[model samples]
Structures are given as structure tokens and as C-alpha cells.
Target: MSVVPGLVSITFRQLGVGEILALLRRTGLEAVEWGGDVHVPVGDVAAAKRTAAATADHGVRVAAYGSYYRAGDHAPADFDAVLRTAVALGAPRIRIWAGAAGSADLTTQQRAGVVGDVRRITELAAGEGVEIAVEHHPGTLTDTLDSALALYAEVGHPGLRPYWQPRLGLGPAEAVHEAGALLPGLVTVHVFSWTADGVRLALADGAPLWQPVLGTVAGASAEAGAERYALLEFVQDDDPEALVRDAVTLRSWLGGG
Candidate 1:
């Protein structure tokens, strides 16, 4: 199966749903992950449904619900609403943060809390036929590859998956290895290029790194016949022009040209 070149709508925070869909269509992208923090707020069923419909109207699929539902930090009631919103948006999966603290900084109690929540949430999502994914991010349990793997082992839920991203501080080789290690459980990828000091660069600047990451992901997806999306995340200066240009770069990276 071919890996889909997609966009995470939050990357274009300034644009409304209509504008975001239009921009995505023009980029020749096939899917979008709508952000709950902005484009579709949790519990806003009407907005979620409308955005989902608009995406389909533009010939784009709702890849996943990019929710800010931080596991172990929020209440069950909040998670319930998050699931409902995902159902409304017709998202196959819901992306969440691992926890409030980094793996190194987490207390034993915190780790247990996160594991329990992840396990519970996985079950909750399963009931709705929706998958749950933890974003590989800093200040969360998935800050490091080892920590992410360990968290998965602790949860051990088939419904749980990781949304892998190129760790900002790592070199190209290390980033590729880190993403590869999560292959068995990877459900989606967030693509971006940034410096150790948090400086955002054009997506093409990381081509040497992203190319292999994409290849690894594509290889795995091909074997399983499961769809995977390499969605553009943050762009330089949040400029729509930069996003358009990056989408072009991403298309080429996905072997479009």
C-alpha cells in the first residue's frame, strides 16, 4: 500500500476549517488530522461533524483526531467527551499525549497512572471501534524511544499505538533508528524539521532524515497492507506558503515525482 501524504490542520492554525480544507486540496494531499485544540474542540459535536463532512467533500480523509487529551492528566469524563468527538469527526484514531512529565522525570506513581489510563482509554476506544495513539513528544512519557517502548510494554494494549515524529534534537541517523524501533506499533507520523534550540526550518532541510524515516514507515505499511500517513506538522513561521512549499517537498519525498 502507498503511504499517504497528508497534513495536520493545526499546522495552519490561522486558517478556518474551510480554508484548511481548501489549502490541503490545493496541495494534492489526501488526508488531514483535525486538531481538537483549534479546528474542532472536544464536545463540539456540530463542528466536528461539519469539519468531517467538509474534508470528505474536498476528497480528503480524516486520518486521526489530533486531540490534546493528555492521558493521566485529565478526567475520565473529559476522555469520554474526546471519544465522542472522535466518533463525530469519523476519525479512525485519537492522538493523545502520554503524560504530563517526561519519562526520566516521571515518578513510579506517575508511570503507573499513565499506564492505567492508557490501558483504560484503549479499552474505551475499542468499544467505539476507534484506535488510540500517543504522540511521541517531549514532556511526556514518550520523550525517548526507550521510554516509549517501555510505556507500550507496560500498557500492552493492542488498541494503543504511537504517532511517531522526528525527535527535534536527534541527528538524522538517530531519528531514523528511533522511528524504526517503534515500527511494530506505529500508526501515524508527524513530519517536521527543527533544531535543538527549537528553531523551525523548512521541511526540505530535513529531507536526508525524513526520506529514510518515510522509507522505513512505507516498508512496514506495505507489509501489513495498512495505510499510514506522513502528515506535515509545524512549518516555518506558520506560513501557508511555507506549508504549500513543504507539501510539495513532502510529495517528492513520498515518491510522487
Candidate 2:
């Protein structure tokens, strides 16, 4: 039941790597998923190494490399760079998008392309001892539970897994069900709470939802003898200070306090 409290670096896009590391230390977070868009850009092995060293120096682990590599949209060559960065960053996993379009919007050929790309990248990542996870996000194939499951089935690779997050407007019960269904292959969770209308709220406000959600994660991780991260994503008003407050709630929920 090793569910570690961590942060998603993109949560503070305005902050530099050093600043984010300091915030993680100040907040007592154990790990971070560095975003490729900023903190550690794709193909920048030097930056990756530097950030990796700094993270280690600050006593924070690299939970995963949050890469924006769209599974089917880009050439396979592009993923080569992404993998290089993740390897240099010493990340255990690389987070990627299923595709740009929603499941319902994708054609059969489009879906197959995404699936093939996922398989290819999974194999490539496995060679380097790194796992690949698709973002459970809207506007992509993983937007729905059924689609996400089907995509994983078709890819059919143990190296590939799904990163779970409560979809916007999803009720706690439904979120629990989704999390449970994805438990077998769950890698990491993006933790946050938002209103049905998209208003971001404090992590404490979502305790009702997260409490049970994290419980399920703990049980599953224990059963599999694996550790998973509950990484805080965005905070209320995109405020850095909001992260400090949210981290308290997150740590309390994880029984860190």
C-alpha cells in the first residue's frame, strides 16, 4: 500500500526547475512527474540530466516523465527523442497522450494507428526498462473507460499502462468504479478536484472522492506489490501557494501527517 504523495511539475509551469524542487521540498512531496513541455523538454538530454540530478539533490524522485507525445500523430522518430529524455531523466515511466481526437470521433483506421503506435512505443520503452502510460484525459481515445480498456486490450502489452484521473464532472462513485477497473494496470494518478462547471477547488474539498479513490489504489498496489504515486496536478486559481495548502490535504489523506 505504498501510495506516495507527489506533484506534477506542470502544476507550476511559471516556476523554474529549481523553484519547483524547492516547492516540493517545502511541501514535503516525495516525487515529481517532470513535464516535457517545460521543465525537461523532449530531446534535451542535457536538461534531463540536469533536472534529474537537481531532483535527486533535493531528495525528490522522478516519478515519471510527462511527455506530450501523441501516440499516432507524430512520427516514430519523435518518440525516440522522448525516450532518450526519459532515460536520461531516470524516469521509471513515460506519460503520453492516446491521440488528439476523442474515441467517438476516431475512425477505425485512426484507432488502429493509435494502437499500433502505442505498441511500438511500449516495446521501445521496455528495452530501456521504462514503462509507458497513456493519459486518461478528454479529447483522446482514453477519455472513456470502455475506450481506454479497449485500447489497452488491443495494444496488449504489459509495458503499457493507463494513468487514471477522475474525469471532469464525474461523481465519486463513478470515479471509484473507473479506478477499480483500471487497477490492474494503473501506473500513477493525477489528483485534483473540480466542479462540474470546471471551477478548480482545494484538494480538501474533494476528500470525499479521493479518500475512497486512494483506498482502492492502496489495496491494488499492495496486492501487486508495487508502488504508485498520487501526484497533485493543478491547484485552485493556479496559485503556487495553493499547492502548499493542497499538499497538506494530500499528505493527511495519505496518512503522512
Candidate 3:
């Protein structure tokens, strides 16, 4: 399968800071994301600044900040603070997770409250010149396409988009097909490996992993003429060398170095 040109930024939430960076080096991947749980905590100003410097020092792009801040659980001030830190990191997009970590018994009104909080934060994001990407991770606010779309409709701002993750359990084809509705509002894409628990399958032995995604994004960019980033979200596997090699595979498919 042919890959779209240009390397996609990626993040490994489970990997330690140095391990993640080392994986990036080994994979030849030039862009990386900060999973707030890992390298940089959301709203941590000093850490974010240091991360920004690391991006330059390593010659890799600081793609976005992945903050697993569920909707209503976070205070408005904290949400704003996190976005501000994202800006300081020179990242244009901040990735948000939409589920409650605890309290499995959330009431309907409670869910609604989460949505409301997200709307307000998104408004702030637009005002601050940053974009918010709601990751399509289920169980939170955006567990499904309908829910995610509803959030977008409620916010009604141009700065909010989706971080699509095509997965086996989510029906990869359906995720890919349903992406049409999200194409116009997409901040970035989260590529998947054919594995369980959001792990990164090895490049060579991996299922025909990246072809379909590359074809789809290439088609979308051609139609919209919008410059978008495909984030290679390697959820696990902390080998920098392998990570960089994976980037090479993607770039070769993308028709670039």
C-alpha cells in the first residue's frame, strides 16, 4: 500500500520520557507529541517550555499536547491554563480525551455537564489561537461519532476538530468511512497498528497497516487543499530506533524522505 508523503507526528503514552524520545530517534520520525500523562503534564508551564526546547534540539516537531482531561472533571481555569501551556510549547493543536476516569456510574446530567465544560474550553482555545482535537476514545463525551459531532455542533467554533483513531474493535473500515463527516473538522489523525490495547505493531510484521490511511488522507488533502498532520500515535513500544525506522516506512510510502 502506498503511504501519503510526509512523516506523521506520534506519541507513546506508556513510554517513559527518555524512552519515547529514544524511540523517535530510532524510528527516524521527526515529529512527536506530549502525552500529558507521560513527558509533560498538562498546564505545566516550565515542563512545556523545556519540551519545546527539546523539539528544537532534536530537530523534531512538537506536534500537539495530548491531555486526557475529561470534560466536566477539569476546572475551567485549569483547562484554560493547559491550553495556554500548549501555546507556550508552540503547538497549534491540543488533544483532549473525553471520558471520566473514575465514577463509572455517571448520570446523564453529569455527562451533559462534561459537554458544557468542553464547549467553554473550546471557545477559549479559539480565542487563544489554538485548536482543540477531541480524540475518538469512547466512554467519555465523544464515545461515538454522533456524540463527537454534537460537541462540535454545540461549540460551533472552527477551532475544534477530531483526532481519529482507526481501530479493529471500532471497525477500521467504518472509522475510515465515517471520517468523511470529520474531514472538514479534523485537526489531526491517530494512526493505528493492528494490535490489541492500542499498541504499535512492528513495521514489517504489521498487518497491511498504513496503506489505507495514507490513501484516505492523500485523497482528503487533495480535495480540500488543507494542510493537515497525520499523527503516528505509537501507543506502546519504546524503541526509538524502531520508531524512526517506522517513520522511514511511512515516508517512503508518502513519497518523501
Whole-model Cα lDDT of every candidate shown, in order: 0.89, 0.94, 0.66
- Order the candidate numbers by TM-score, best to worst: 2, 1, 3
lDDT of 1 by residue, 81-161 (tens): 999999999999999998888998978998999889999999999999999999998899999888999999998888998
Q: Pick out the ten consecutive residues of candidate 1 with the lowest summed lDDT.
A: 166-175
RMSD of each: 1.1, 0.9, 3.8
Clashing residue pairs in candidate 1 are: none
Residue pairs with colliding backbones in model 2 are: none
lDDT of 3 by residue, 61-152 (tens): 77677776767887667787778788888887788876574224567678678767777788888787888888877566666677677767
C-alpha TM-score for every candidate: 0.97, 0.98, 0.81
For candidate 3, what is the lDDT?
0.66
- Residue 15 accuracy (lDDT) in model 2: 92
Q: Which wins on lDDT, candidate 1 or candidate 3?
A: 1
